[model samples]
Target: HVVDELALLSANIVEVVHDRLSSNVRAGTTGVTLSLETEDQKHMDKLIQHLKEKSIDFKVLT
Candidate 1:
């Protein structure tokens, strides 16, 4: 989620990992996982068409 896109991104971020959890549910890890970087590809194609009109599940490795 990058904390809701970080004021429309001016980032050159690298290797920032995080950890804190409960409710493991056999290690499915129950909710919210994100990694984002934007050096601008037309704002990553309008944030991938606003996450595909809010259907939400996303993956774009480029």
Candidate 2:
């Protein structure tokens, strides 16, 4: 459900880069490192804000 929500939030993103090197699954939760690339900075900010609103822990990798 969370992942689907994430997808919806990132619908405007042009591409999503998945960090397979650091992605993994734990006991109950799976960790997914994604870098979203978008032409509009506002869209990026909206996505990040949505993630925060959903209480999803995430780190921006640059």
Candidate 3:
């Protein structure tokens, strides 16, 4: 159950990021980089780990 929730949360986060990237692209923000930086790097790491374990492919844009 926890894994499922994590997956859902990860998917949502990725979707929001992608949407933002799309808008930035449309606004002519060329050569832009996107990264996930947080005070809780461990939490982000864990999220990536969980996604990898579930065979999800996420591109780290930076």
Q: Specify the highest-lDDT model's number.
A: 2
Candidate with top TM-score is: 2
lDDT of 2 at 29: 58
- Candidate 3: give the clashing pairs: none
- State the lDDT of candidate 2 residue by residue for 1-62, as single tens digits: 55676678655434545443443645555555554565477877887788789897788776
lDDT of candidate 3 over 1-62, digit per residue (tens):
43364655553333232343554355644433335443366777777777688775455554
Clashing pairs in 2: none
**What's the true lDDT of residue 33 in model 3?**
31
lDDT (CA) for every model shown? 0.57, 0.64, 0.52
Backbone clash total for model 1 is: 0
Which 10-residue window of candidate 2 scores lowest in summed lDDT?
12-21
lDDT-wise, the better of 2 and 3 is 2
Q: For model 1, how does the per-residue alpha-carbon lDDT over 1-62 read when each residue is reduced to its tens digit?
A: 54454334454444444444655433644444455677668976777777677676656665
- Model 3 RMSD to the real structure? 8.0
TM-score of each prediction = 0.29, 0.55, 0.41
Name the regions of candidate 1 deviating beyond 4 angstroms.
1-29, 41-45, 52-54, 57-62
- Clashing pairs counted in every model: 0, 0, 0
